[model samples]
Target: MSRNPRILVTGATGRLGRLLVPRLLARGAHVRALTREAGRAASLAADGAEVVVGDLGDGASLRHAFHGASHLFLLSPISPELAAEQIAAIAAAKAAGVQRIVKLSGSHWTIEPPGRSLSGDAHAHIEAALRASGIAHQVLRPNAWLQVTLARLAGELAAGDVLHAPPAFPKVAGIDARDIADVAAHALLGPEPSATDSPWVLTGARAVDHHEIARIASALSGRRIVAEPLSREALAQRAAQAESPYVAQVHAQFAALIGTGEAATVTDTVERVLGRPARTIEAFVAEALAA
Candidate 1:
């Protein structure tokens, strides 16, 4: 893509969007950041992005945002109908003559165990939409966020000595959100050629289980920690009590995955994309514990 092309970024007010917009601007791309809440678009405006009020569910709004845009950064939020929302947005982008789209598809979760499940189904629909639109696109499937470990292990980290849930042997290939954002930004503004349409999987440097994370946190904080396991049913009940139906469902699914140890495999996808090793769990633990 040319430098300073009119680029439209959906979900610009989100976590990745916040970083992605600024990164694109640093590459000299003029951006229109689309958000459902106009007030929250202030950050984008401050970062030299043209803020547009819009929703993925509304075709007219998406059309308006896609207008006069050459490249589109399509980031569908985590939801059951992510694919449908993305397809609608892609249709609008095609009508607006957009040339490129960078989409955040499924995670390592879906990639490792491909099926007709919710996450997989949603990503499939999005890919279908991009293909049907005949738009040049890149699909990124990242691994589970390191934040998941941080979120669950925060209390332990703060106290400087405990593993809140999961057995010590439970392993996961945890990735940092910032790294994922970097890869997304790189793909959005990087050189494109015959290799533009391939699917890229983003990941952190290493695969780590709770025991390793606990050890890292211990080293970082200079304290001893005890790893403890929680039952899947208990975690699900806790999630349900927290009033997050979606999280409850995910927790139950995760419990099943954990039982099968299907989440243990690690991939070299991040190295292929970024031309370097991904961040390690130790780095994540140190960074998150400090935060």
Candidate 2:
């Protein structure tokens, strides 16, 4: 890879992509951001990224976006069409002669049986397609994002000192999205190419259940927070009131994985890739509360 590879970053306006674009720019990489809405990409454009309007559904547009790009950071939102869109993007990338691809995948996906989780299945399909494409690729499979998990309890935390969730939710070493982005930047820019068809499973320093998360949040927020376990029916009611019925069903499936303790497995992949310890829940809580 060249010192200043022309990198194409998809989903630039999303959480991880927003963090990633700036980091890539800081390293003197020439970044081209692909977004569905050009207007939303203004900040990226202001930050020296060549923002291009494109849609994953449009093959011609994807080809245009991939043009002249040596490296591709492939990220997409979770949807039923996710696998199809990523496969399309992979084809475009290969056609454009892109040298490397770093894909954002999901943790425990390899262990998941078919039809376990919709999102996991979609990502697994995409990973298979990438391998078949024969591109030099690296996959970052991160555990449940700490920010998303905390956001679910934000209202409860603000109203009182109790954090509630379904009972028997297993421990998970949830990782910060920023840490995932940092590892991605390293993989995209590092001289040694990542092992082909290999994936890096990222996690926090240690696994913790909701009780531990509550304690950590309380310590950081200067409040005495306690964990309140709820029944499956109660959790269903809460999910129904909070989001669409379909989304609630999806959440239930993921919660089932946690209930089974599958999401708690930890790996030292982040430290191995970034040469630094992964961020902890305590630190994430402190920074989030401060912000």
Candidate 3:
């Protein structure tokens, strides 16, 4: 409850947690980072945060990770067993006297009325667990990440080939992952804002149709890459042919959501939280392409 609480961050070796740890330390929070690999601890230690080797499934390791920490950052990625993993982490945080939790949730997924989709269903279960755990917390449902487009299509784009997957007509707002981190950091470290308990639908200040994203990507790279729309079945087939298992699953999920037009809506949570306009798709593409 005091300023600069001891914070335990799960998934310290991950994209979001790795970025979050440094920011938390900058705010003077004593951070204990949890990573499955002992080798990864050096990086966190180098940054002046305590690193504990642990897994979300291993209760003993989690207990060690949360010892003396007053706040927990929970970001258990979606998988076949996400609900169990999140529940374990939440239980450990509650038992260890952790004061608050900041859960990283899916953007367009919802299960309030009991949807059959895995993401929606799983996220809802996890949220219910967090609520039941009785921990003071904030839930951030960030919009579809703009960075995934680069990461997922890097090989295809690098070869100057068209990304033949979903339709370019679907309207989806792309939010930068950095903005998500900024909001999470503010919630964890800033003076407790009045809406900390509320669910924040974080999104870019503006929405960009997929067609525009494809056009901008082509312009930035000097190559014409068409975003070919495909049927749900065709998209699944394409994902199955991809080299990375992660990308394959993601494409399949996005294809389904886009088909249903679930991801087309936009929100202004980023502006509401950070008091500034969020980054645009063009800016994201330009920076990523340059990188």
Candidate 4:
């Protein structure tokens, strides 16, 4: 009789990890959630995860958390140290004999040749470590998130009629974070991922621009909102003050290719993996407005 897979989830208290822990828990998997802050993970412990305090930068703590775990869910916030930290996690997982890893990776379109984008380069480095470790792993490459890219627009609409934002040209297939969580759960708890199909590129059902976003918001909220570009100085300031300068620089790279239509590819990965249509833009907007 085999025991249930003991999965270790890093960043378990974060946006995607918090959502994923519940999905794995609902399926009766044995889960160990790793957090740097012990005080913030009580909810995870209450949900039946063996909450353990561990830091990616602190190897001893990571090994202690990884002990006896059969699988790993790897995620972290954007930072200049992202590459080194996740690379360390991969090594720790290998030493602890963890059999599988599911890594939420940078979007595929955002990656270029080495040194092109800081975050992209970071993901690339961590992925290389995963491959070298000879562990079974799946990498999920999700596109623009509705939570980050579009949810704020709803709040701005609530404040006034006119949306103080430029009508962007790029058609982004922004995905709901819930969809991302769902796909990641499948990778972690479902059948082992094949190396040939190791990396999954995920996006929404259709592409939409800021103008379409404004149009949808108008219809949903019953308010006539117009899209207007913010000042260059304002945009630059926001990027400059971004929490992770690495992320800020990578976003600038993404901004440079906005009009080239390089990131508009929509995939059926979520549908094929989950056996349903990927959640649509309208659904995302409806939920955003409701929130």
Candidate 5:
């Protein structure tokens, strides 16, 4: 019998990472999870993952985590240093003799006229670096996360019927993070690397506008939810109130992309890889609310 691959999973405490770890465990892959905080990794350790305390910025820590691992699932938190962090991780994986790396990249990262989206530009740079490294790699570029939208607007959805946000013009086929995790698990544990170097664009079953989202929210929450389009300035003000100015700026840029209909494209990558339909936004909202 062939032995299961030893996989090193970065961002193991993150939204997708948390889900992917258990799925990998279920598949009988030997999983090692890297996290900065050992305290936060206790639950993953309990779930049979070999948790390693490591910082993506710290070369020594990442080298230690990558040691003896045959495969790697590379994901890092969004930050100004995202590109640097991922590149460092890739270098560490290569030095440790990891055979393959499945990186969680971003949708529209390959879009022309680069640097349009800060996050997309960073991911593109990392992808380029990965290609230069000559490592066997596959990239999964998921669209706007339904979980992020739901979490950001949870309070508004619960308190009132109005779902206020910037205009949704181009529409978005928002994907569930859990589906991304499922796909990542398959990529890490699959018998062979992807046939091509082209990144896979993962999306939900269909594109949806805010109106559709409001309707779904209403049905799920048993309340009349209305889509309220806010001005860019208004959206920025709200984001600033909730988070940092940088976050507000990023959100504004994303809103502009959505307004221009640039983010509405859907793809069959998820179903093609997993042999099952991607989870719907309605289902994600329902599960999140229940939890």
Candidate 6:
């Protein structure tokens, strides 16, 4: 890596990438954010990041984006092709002489031995590729996101006082997306590279169930908000509305893992990496409400 690394970031328009890009820029790194649409990256280009429009499925675009990059921060949308696309990205990075990479991966709860979620299986395959590629890399396995898990409930609260939660584990320690972004920035810009063998698992400071989340919302909104469990039919409809067949399968797999023990464990990885306690659910809800 050069004294000043030029970092190429994929999924730059998504929630986590939007947060990570500015953090990398603040650290004086040369940030090149990739998007498939030129128009979507207009703001990124305006934010002093070198925005490149590319697709993981498109090799010419990947080559163009990988040119002269010292490191790659890889993230892809949820799809069945995730493993193949990311593996190809690693190969392209190596061919471009990019020596280091950081990958945002699926949390442990979503994973199983095999034939589970496409999301989990994809991450496992890509992680294996990273090991075989010999790239200086670190994988971050972030737990359930507050933004994805609860922000919708908060948004729904604006219209009604009830949250229709699907069946899930009793208590889940969901981490904030901001915390994950911070860990990613550290992994990418730290003084030295982390071992590729071990993945960093991220979680929030505490675990809380849907009922507890309702209480928090009630407390924050100063109104009575209830968490009503979604019926199996409603849940089935929700899964049916997924964007693709592969994603629908992934959602079904996720639904199957809801009652497992893995979803409730909390880790100190965030505090260890950033030297501060992890962000809390209350804070995440407050921010969601404010937004």
- Judged by TM-score, which candidate is best? 6
Q: How many residue pairs clash in each candidate?
A: 2, 0, 2, 2, 1, 0
* Residue ranges of candidate 4 with Cα displaced over 4 Å: 1-3, 112-114
> Candidate 5 regions off by >4 Å?
109-113, 152-154, 168-170, 219-223, 231-234, 241-247, 288-291
For candidate 1, list the clashing residue pairs, or say none.
205-278, 205-279
Off by over 4 Å in 1: 111-113, 152-155, 167-169, 193-197, 231-234, 241-247
Model 6 stretches with alpha carbons more than 4 Å out: none
Q: What is candidate 5's lDDT per residue for 46-154, written digit by digit as tens?
A: 9999999999999989889998999989998767778999999999988988888999987763344587778788899998988888788888888888877656566
lDDT values, one for every candidate: 0.74, 0.84, 0.75, 0.83, 0.82, 0.86
TM-score of 5: 0.90
Q: Model 6: what TM-score?
A: 0.94
Candidate 4 lDDT over residue span 58-158, tens digit each: 98998798888899999998888888999999999889888989999988876645666678888988888888888899999898787877646767766
Instruction: Estimate, for each residue in 1-291, the C-alpha lDDT of model 1 and write its tens digit.
Output: 555678888878887788788888887889899988889999789889999988898888887788899988888666766777888888888888888888887665664455624566678778777877777788887766776545766655676576766643667777777778778877777766243456776666666677777777777787787666767686656767743566356555665664455556677877777787787777767766776
| Tens digit per residue, CA lDDT, model 2, 182-254 | 9999989985564554677888889898888788898787788888888668766778774455556667788
Model 4 weakest 10-residue run by lDDT: 161-170
Q: TM per model?
A: 0.89, 0.91, 0.86, 0.93, 0.90, 0.94
Distance (Å) between predicted and true CA of 86, model 2? 0.4
Residue 280, model 6, lDDT: 87
RMSD of each: 2.5, 2.3, 3.2, 1.9, 2.5, 1.7
